[model samples]
Target: MSTSPLPRPSDLIARRRAEVAALLATDAAQAALAIHGTPLLLLDTARVEQQFRRLRDALPFVRFHYAVKALDHPAALAVLDRAGCGFDVATSEELALLVDGSVDTARIIHTHPIKKPAEIEHALAVGVRTFVVDNDAELAKFSRAPRDVRLLVRLAYRNPHAKSDLSSKFGVGFHEAERLVREARRRGIRVGGFSFHVGSQLDDPDRFVHAVDETIAFMSRLERQLSVRFDTLDIGGGFPVGYDRDVAGIEDIASGIRPSLERVRGRYTILAEPGRILVAEAATLVTSVMGIAERADGRWYYLDDGVYGAYSNVVAEDVHPLVFAVTELDGDAEQATHRWATLAGPTCDSADVIAREMLLPDLRVGDPLASPAMGAYTAVTSTRFNGRPLTSIAVLSQAPATGEVAIPAATSGVGGPQPQTVP
Candidate 1:
C-alpha cells in the first residue's frame, strides 16, 4: 500500500498566501483592503470547511459546532455558516456578533459554563435554547430564563493528560451530572443532553473517547434511574490540532475517537464545540518589532501589539506565546538566544510582558514577527488596555485537496469575494 506525502509547514504557508491573493484579486474587496497595517490575522476559510466536512463525514452521527470564540471574523463565520455548522458562544456579546452577522439564530447554541443574568436573558430572547449548566445556582438561573431553554449538563473532563485544568474550572463532576439532569427535569425545562471539554492542546486522542464514555455511562445510569432519555451529548470542543511537533495530528485524534463514538450511534445527539482545534493553525498574528533593548544579562524585543492588545493571554494566563520572525533575521548568540527571553510590549505599564524568556532566532526593530496558532484566544480576547486600536485583519483560504493557501488582500473587514473553486 502507498500513502500521500505530508505537506511541509513552508509549503502549507505558501499555499495559504496564494489563496489570499486570489481572494484579494476580486474587485469587490480590492478597494476595502488597508494598504498599510501593522499586525494582522490571515484566516483559511476553505481549510476550516474542509476540516468540518471531514469531521462530519468521519463521524456522520455527530454534529460539529464551530466555536465562534475561536475566530469571529465575519468571513470565517460565513464559512462555518455555509458549511452547515452551528455556532457556540460564551457571552451575549458573542451571540450578538453572530446574530448581527446573519448567522441563523436557530443554529446558535449559548454555552458558557458561567452565565450571567443578562447573557441568559439575551440567549433566551434570541432563541438560543442549547446551554450547559454546572451548578445549582446556574441551574436555578436557567430555570428562571425568560423562555424555555434546552440544557446540556456539563461533565468534568478530569483526564490527567489535559494541559489546562479545565475539569477543575468548569463542568459538574461525572458523579454529579445525573443530579443536574434531574434538576433540569424537575424544572420543567427540556434537558437536551450533556457536554464535557478536555482542555486545550490535548495530546491524548483517547481523552475524547474517555470523556464520551464517561458521559454516556452517566447518562445511561441517569436515564435508567430517572427514566428519561437525553436528546444531546455535547463533547464540548477540545479536538486537538498540532501547534508543534509534540502535539498529536488531527488524524490521530479523529481516528482514535471515531470507533468509540460510533458505538453510541442511537443514544444521544452528539455535538461538539471546537474552538482551538478549528482555527488555531488557520491564522497567524503579524506584529512588528518596534525596538530591541540589550542588557548585560540579556536582550528584549518590544512589539507594537503587546500583552494589552494582542498578547493578552500571556499575562492573563501566563502562557509563553509561540513567536517567530515573520520575515527572516540574521545574528548571533549574544543577540539571539535559542532559550527563552523576556519579550515586552510598548506600553507605560511595567507589567506589559508578552512572553518571558521565549526562544527566538534573533531580534531587530521593524522586523515582522509572526505567531502561528494565534487564531484562537488571541484577537477575540484582545483589550484596549492602553487605548490601542485593534489591528487590521485578513482572511486566507486553502484548497485542502491541493494544500494551497492564499493571502487575500482584505478589505475593511470580512467582506471578501465568494470563494473560487479549485481545479
Candidate 2:
C-alpha cells in the first residue's frame, strides 16, 4: 500500500505560520498586546501542562525532570511542579528558582557534571540527593557529602547533527566512563546507574534507542565486572521540537526506545530530562516593526525584538522560528503582495539580524509580527544588548467561557508591576 508523503519545507513553514497566527488571534494574545504592547511573549501555563502531559503519556514508566534551563519562569515551574514533574537543574540559581517556588527538594536533581563547591553545598543543603558527575574531580567533590548522596555517571554519545551536541562538553566515552565508574567506586561514591544525552534537539529516533541499548549493555557489563549495581538510568533530554519544520514528536521518539526500556522496566529506575520539548511550544512572541529601511540588498524590516531578545534561540541553537505578519493570520495575507526581505532586530550590532531573506508582506513601521515555539531557550538566553530592556512576558490563562483568554500578571523578569489582571 502507498503511504502519504511527508510535508515539504514550504508546507511546514506555512503550517507553523498558521499556528502562530491562530495564537495571535487568541484573547490572551489580544489582551497582552493591549496592555504590554509589542516585543512581548504570551506564556500559556496550560500549554506547558499540556506538553508535560504529552511527554508523560508518551513515556509512562520514565520519570521526567523538566530541565530548568529551558525556561525558568516561575509560572512554568509552578505549573510543572503542580503536575508532579521533577526538575533537573545545572546551577544553584536554577535550584533557587525551584526552592523559591516551594518545590519539594525531593523532586530536584543536580545534573551539572561540574559544579562549584558552593553550588554542591547549596543543593545538598536543600535536601537534593541525586547528582550527576562525569569526572574524578567532580566525584571527589561529593566524596565528603552524606552517604545517601548518589551520582549518575554521565556517558557521552556524540551526534554532530544535533543542534547542540552536549556530549562534547560534559559526557564520558566508553573508556573514560569505565575509568570514572571505577574511580567513583574507589572513592566510595554510589554510582547510580548511568545517564547520557544523545544530543540537544536530536531528530534521530534510532540514536535514542541506540544510546539506551548501549548504556544498558555497558551498565550490565560493569555490574558483572565491578560487582556494583546501578539502580537508575537517565536518558538525558534531546527530544526535538519542530520550530520551522516538521520533526519527530515525543511519542515517536518514545516508541523507538520503549521496547528497549520495557526489557528492563522494573530492574532500573528510568528517568528523562526534557527541556525543549516540554516548554518550547508553550510561548508565543509578538514583535512590531520598529523601523523599515531599504538596504542595498533589499528591503529590511527592523523589529523591536531580535536575536538579542526572544530570538536568541536562532543564534544559540541554530533553529529558525517561522515569522508571520499579523496580516497573514488575519486572512489578508493572500491579497497582499510579498517580497523577500531581511528581518533585523533593534540593535546597533550587525549580528542582531533575525532572519535573512524572509518573505514577508509589506509591513508598516508599526505593523506586528508573531513567532511561535518561542518558549525554550529564547527569553532565558536573551541578552540586554544596546541598553535595551528585556521583552516582557505576559502569563496567560483561560477564562470560564470557551476560547476566552486572561492574563494573570506581567511576569517577573520584564521588571513589570506585580500580579494584576489585564482585561
Candidate 3:
C-alpha cells in the first residue's frame, strides 16, 4: 500500500529532470555529448547495477536474469554481471555476448520460445541447458539431448494493453502448455518449469500477481496429473518503471507477487528475465535539433535521431520519450510562452517522426534534446535507417546523488519546458 500520498506524475518527471540535468551539468556529460554529437546515448553502468539491486531487494526470492535484448551495451552487461545478475538471451548473438564476456554460462538461460535447431545447439554447447519452448516442433529438437537439458514451457497470458504483448508472438495456452510438458517427458527430456512474460511495461501489479497465481496453479495441477515435478518458475520480465510517468512501484508490484511466492517458495526455483527495468534507467538519449521548420501543422524541430534509430521505442512500442531543450535543463526555461511543436526524426521516411504536438520553449537550431529511460529497447532495436549511423553511447560515472536515470517521461507535453520536466 502507498504510505505517503503518491507523488504526482509531474513530480516524478521533475525528479528525473533533475537527475538528467545534473548528469548534463557535469563536464563529462557535456564533453561526451559534444564529442559524440547529436543523437548520443549516455549509458551509466552504475545505474544498471542500482536498478538490479533495487529488484533484488524488492523480490529477494526471485533470481534475476538481465534480458540481454534490452540494452546489451557491453558496459551495461559488465555492470549487471558484476552485480551477480544472470543473463537471459534470446538470440545466438546475445548468448555470444555473455560467452565472449566470460560470463559463467550456467548463469544464462536461453528464453526464446522459437529458434532454429542450430541456435539451440549453439547455446547448449556453451553450457546453456535451460531453454524456453512453446511448441512440439521446438521440443522435438531436444529428443536426443542430454539429461542435463531442461526446458521451460512458455505460457501465453494475453495483455492487449501492454506496450508489447509478447503473448501474440510466443507462449502456449494452458492446454498447449500441458501437451508440451507431456511431450517433453515422452521425449525423455527434463522439464524445468513454466515461464511467461506478463507483457512489456505492464502497469497492473494485480495482473502480474494474477499471472503468477495462474502459472503456479497450473504447475500444481500438472504435477498432480502427470506425476512429474517442476524445478523452476520463470516469471518473465514486465516490471514497470516510470516512463512518461511512474507506472507501478517495484515494491507495489512485489507486494502482489511475494505472497504468492512465499506459499510456494521452497517448492520451486523462482526466476525473472528483466529486460527494460534493469537497463531502462541506466541510459539516456541526448539528441540535437538539427533543423527547425515551420511546417503546415506547426513548428517542427527535426533531430538527428529518428524512429529507425534511438527513438525506435516511440515508433515500435508506441511510447513517446520526453523531449527537452537544453535551456530547460540549464534552469533557464522560458515559461512566459510555450508552443506546441513537432519533434521529427532525421529519417527520409515520414513515419520516422518521434513525437507530435510536443509543447516546448522556443527551440533554436542545434539545441540539445535529452530523452531519459532510453537505455533499453532504444538501442537494441534500432536500425541503420536512412544511412544514419547508430547512436554512440557514453558510459557515465557513479554519482548516486546526481539523479535517477529512468526513461524520459513519456509525456512530452505534460510539463513542457518546465524546470521540473524531463525527456
Candidate 4:
C-alpha cells in the first residue's frame, strides 16, 4: 500500500501564504489596518487556542505549560488560560502578566534555573510552589522555602543543530545533575522530579526522544542508587516552529517521544513547556515601506518595522520569516515585475536591515508588506532602540461584535508616536 507523501517546503510556504492572504482579507484585518495601519501585529487568539489544543491532542498524557517568555501578550495568555492550559514563567515580570490576568497560580511553574532570592520570594508569595534549579546555589536558595514547595532539577541535553543551543547558557550535564539532586536531598529539600530542554527551534525528533529516554533512564538509575521516588518530569519547551520552511510537526515530535513517556506515565507526571509551536502562527506582522533607495549593492526598501521591532526574531532567534508585499497577496503584482531588493528597518542604525536579497515586487514608499508565523519571540524580544516605540498589536480574532479590533492596553503605545494609517 502506498502512502501520501509529506508536504514539501514550497508547499508549506504556499499554505502559509494562502492563510496570511485569507487573514489580511478579513474585515478585522482591514479594520485593524484602517485604524492602526502598518507596523502592526494582528494577534488571533483563536489560533493560539487551536495550537494549544493540538499540543494536548497529540500528547494527551502529558500536561502542557505555555512558555510565557515566548509571547507575553495578554490576549494570548487569556486564550490559553481559558483553554485550561498551564503556564511556565522565567521571570517575575512574566509572572506578573499572569498575575494581572488573574491566572490560577496553582497552574503556573517557575522554570528559570537561576533566580534572585527576592524573585523567589515574590513567586512563592504569589502562590507559585514549583521551581526548577540546575546548580547547588540555586537549590540552596530554595532550602528555606515551605515544606509544600517542590523543585525540579534541570538537565542539559545539548543540540548544536538548534537555532538556539539553550544548554549553552542554562542546564547541567549528567555529573552536575547528579550532584545537584544529591545536594538537594542532603539539604532536606524535596526534589520532586527532573526537567530538561533539548534546544530551541530543534527540528530533530530523535533529539527529543533521546533526551526523554536519557532523562528517564537517569531518573530510574538515580532513584535506585539514591532510594528516591520522583513524581514529575518536565520536558522543557523547545518545540520547533516552521519559519520559511517545513519542519517536524508537533504530532511527529510527540510520536517519537510518546513511547518513552508512556512507559512511565502511571508512575510520573509528564509535563511539557511549549512556547514557539503554540504562538508562532497566531500573529501576522504588517509593515509599510518608509522609503526606497538604490544602494551600492542593489535596490533597498526601508520598512517601518524591522529587527528592533516585530521582526526582532530575525536577529534574536536566527530564523527568517517570509515577507510578502500586500500587492502580491492581492494577486495584482506579476512575478515578472518582482526584483531582489534589500529590506531595511526604520532605524538610524545601519545594522537595522530586515532581509537582504529578498525577491519582492517594485515597492514604493508606503506600500504595505506582511510576514506570518510571527506570534512567538517577536514582540516579546522587541526593543525600543534608537527611540523607536514598540510596534502596536491589534487583536484580530477576538474582536467585539461591532467588528472593532481590540488593541491591548499594554501594547497600545498610549503616549508614544501614534500609529499612522497607510495611504
Candidate 5:
C-alpha cells in the first residue's frame, strides 16, 4: 500500500522564524549577543519547566523520566528537577551529573540496555536500582547485584523512519526477550518489566498505541507462559518535537497513548522517557556570519558555529532548523533583496556545511543567524572540532525584563545562560 508523504517544510511547519526573530531582537538577547558575541545559545529555563508540566498534564497517569542524554545541561536538568520530574540516565557521567546536582537517586532510572560492568556498578552504587538489559551478558552483570535491582528487558521494534533506529543497536526480539527473563529468573535477578524506544522524533501518534498494545499483550502472554508477572512497562521516549516542520502535538499523542495505557492501569507502573519533546524548544542557537564569500557555485556565508558545533542536530538527526536573520526581526523585512545562499560553518571540513539554497536576506559580516528548537541534541552532541570554543548560552527570563536580568550561577561545565539586560 502506498503511504502519503509528509507535507513540505513550509506547509506543515509553524511560522517559527517570526518567533525566533522577535526573540533575537529583544533587548535582553541583543545585549547578551553584543557582549558575548555570536555562537551563543539562548536558553529559557522556564521553557524546560513548562514542557515538563505540559507532558505531565497530558499523561497524568504515566510517570515521566526526563532522558538526560537529550540535553545534559545542568541548569536545564535543574529546572526539571525543581519541577518534580524524574530522570533517565544512560552512562556514568549522566548519572554523576544528576548525583552531583544532588537530585534524589530514587527519582532516577538507568535505561541503557547494555553497559560495561564498571558502568553498571557505578549506577548501582549510586542508588539506581531500576535498569534496562536485553541479553544474557547484560543480565549476567546484575547477577552479583542486590536482589532489589529490577531489570527491564529492552524489546526491539525497528522503524527505519525514526531519526535514530534505536532497535538496530539496542533491544531484543520476542524470543530473546523471553529468554532473557528466564535467564534472569535462573540467576535469581528480579525482572521488573520491559522497555522499548519506538524511535526518536516520530511524527505518528498511532504507532505509540500499536506498540503499547502489543507490549501489554506480550507481557500478559509471557506471564501466563513463564509463570512470571511483569510489574512495570516503560514506554520509552519517542515523542516528536517540531523543527523544520510541525509533527504530532504532544496532546494529540497523549490522546492516542492514554486510552491504551488505561488498559494496563492499576496493574502496571507506566513510565515514559521524554528526551527531545521536553528540551528541543527550550533553547535557540545564535551564530554570526564570519564572512560572505562568492564561490564558483554561489554565495557562501560562513558562520562561527557549524555542524561540529550547535548545528550538530542538523547533521546527526536530519532536523532542519529554520534560520532567521536578526535584521528581519528588527523590522527590516524590506531588505535589498533575497537570494539563495550556501550557509557554511567555521570548520575547515567540507562536511561542516549547514544548509544549501537558503533564501536569506543580503547578509553582511557580523550578521546574526538564529535557529530555534536547538535545545535537544544540538549542544549535547556537539564536538570541539577545529579547536573552536564551546558556544556560550544565555538564559533569558520568561517575560521581557524591564531592566537588568538576573544570571543564574554556572551549575556545571555546561553552564546556565548568563543574563542579558533588557533595558
Candidate 6:
C-alpha cells in the first residue's frame, strides 16, 4: 500500500511538470527544448554509487567492470568512473569513447569473444593489454600479431534459470576453451584467465556460485594437464536488477557467491561484467499519453514513444513494459482505478504495441507514464523504424541536504546529431 496518498492524474501531471521545471530551471534553454514534450530517461547516479559501495564492502577482492553496452552515455560513464570502476568494452568505438572521456586505456579491457584484427592491433597500440578470445581461430589471429598481450579464454554453459531466457550461442565448449588456453601458452602469449556469462536477468542467486565452482574445477584440471595456471577469472555479467516485485535483490544474489569464493584455490583474480543490475533500477523512462480510445471490448492508449524508442524491447523480445500511471486527488484522497488499458505506440506497424491487456485506471491524453528498469536495454537498442526519434536523456545526482534528486545538465537533441534520434 502507498503510505503517501496518490494524487489525481491532473495533479500528478502538474507535480511532474513542476518537478521537471524546477530541475531544468538552471539548465540552458536549448537543453530544455531538446528534452521538452517527449519521452525521457532519468538516471540516478547516487544509486549507482550505493550499489558500488555495497559491492566494494562485500567483495573487496573482486573488481567490477561496468559493461559499456548496457548504457554508455557519458554522464552515466562519469558516475561509474567517479565510483572507481573500470569498463568492459566490445568494440573499438567504445574504447575510443573511453579515451575521449579521459578514462584510462589500461583500465578498459577489450573482452569481446571475437575481435577484428585491426581492433586488436589498435587496442594493443593504445595500451589495452587484456583481451578475451573463445576459439582457436580468434586466438591464432592474435597469436601472430607483433605485440604480446594477455589473453582470456571464454567458456559456454547452460543456466536453466535466466530471466532474459538466453541459451548458449556465444561461448566455446570446455574442450575448446582448454585448446585456446594451451595454444596461447604455445604461442608465448600471456594466458591471463577464463571467462563466462550465464544469461542476463538471472533470478537464481546460486547461478554465479555454481558456475564459479565448475570454472574452478575446469581451471584446476587444465592446470594439472597442461601445466599452466591463469591469474584472472572473469565471471561475465548477468547480475539481476529489480524490474517487478518478483525480481531478486543484489544482496540475495551475491550471498551465494561467498561459499564458492571460499572453495576456490588459486592466485587468480576474480572480476565481473555488470551492466543491467547497475543501471536498470537506477533509471526510469517517462513518456506521455498521446491518444486514448475506448472500444466495446477493450481500451487503447497510445504513447508518443514506441517500439522505435522506449518500447524497442517489446518489438525485439515481445515483452510488455511495466507501466506506472500517476494521478492527483482531492481531499488528500488517493486516485482509484476505474478501467483496464492496452497500451500502443504512435506507429503504423501492427507490431507496435507496448503492452496488451494491461490494467490501468481511466486515463486521458497527455498523462505521463513511467517505466522503471528501462535504463539498460531501452536507449541503447533503439531503432529508426517508421522514422521515429529517440527519447531525450538526463542524469540525476542526489542532493545531500534534501535527500531528493537533483537533475543535472544533459546532452540532449532531437532527430539531428544523434542517429538514433532521427525521425
lDDT of each model, Cα atoms only? 0.68, 0.87, 0.81, 0.86, 0.83, 0.70
- Candidate ranking (lDDT, best to worst): 2, 4, 5, 3, 6, 1
TM-score, cand. 1 vs. native: 0.80
| lDDT digits (tens) for residues 10-61 of candidate 2 | 7677777677777777776787788889899989889899999998898899
Model 6 per-residue lDDT tens digits across residues 1-423 = 112323344543344434433433433322433555557776667667777777666666678888988777776677789788989999988887777778887678877878888998888888888888877778887766555477888777687667554436568778878777767778877777788888787767677778888888898888899887778888878877644445556666667776676455247778888887777666666777999876765788998888877677666634445676645222122346445567888888767788876656567888876676677777878876777766777666655665544445444421112212211
Off by over 4 Å in 5: 1-14, 331-335, 398-404, 409-423
lDDT of 5 by residue, 1-423 (tens): 112322333743336766687677677676767667778888777789989999999989888999999888877888899889999999998999899889999999999987999998888888999999988888888989988888899888888888888899999988889888888898899999999999999857777888888899999999999888889999999999888767898899999889879888789999999999998898888888998988887789999999998898888988887787777765555534677788999989999989997877788998888888898888788888898877677777554344455444322126434433345
Q: Please provide, for model 1 over 85-185, each residue's C-alpha lDDT reduced to its tens digit, 9 standing for 90 to 100.
A: 88999888788878887888888887787888878888778788788888888888866664456788777777666656578888777567777777767
Per-residue lDDT of model 4, residues 1-423, tens digit only: 112222233877778878989999987788777876789998888899999998999999998999998988877888899899999999998898899889999999999998999999999999999999988789889888999999998888889999998899888888888888888888999999999999999979899999999999999999999999999999988888888888999899988988889899999999999999999999999999999988788789999998988899999998898998888785554443666788999988888888897777777899899999998999888889988888888876555465555544326421222223222
Best by lDDT: 2
Better of 4 and 6 by lDDT: 4
Q: By TM-score, who's the top model here? A: 2
The true-versus-predicted C-alpha distance at residue 177 of model 6, in Å, is 1.5
Clashes of 3: 8
Better of 4 and 5 by lDDT: 4
Q: Check candidate 6 and list the clashing pairs.
A: 7-327, 7-328, 7-329, 8-327, 8-328, 8-329, 9-327, 9-328
- Give the TM-score of each candidate: 0.80, 0.95, 0.91, 0.93, 0.92, 0.84
What are the clashing pairs of model 4? none
Candidate 4 Cα errors over 4 Å, as ranges: 1-9, 332-336, 399-423
Better of 2 and 3 by TM-score: 2
Give the Å shift of residue 301 in candidate 4: 0.1
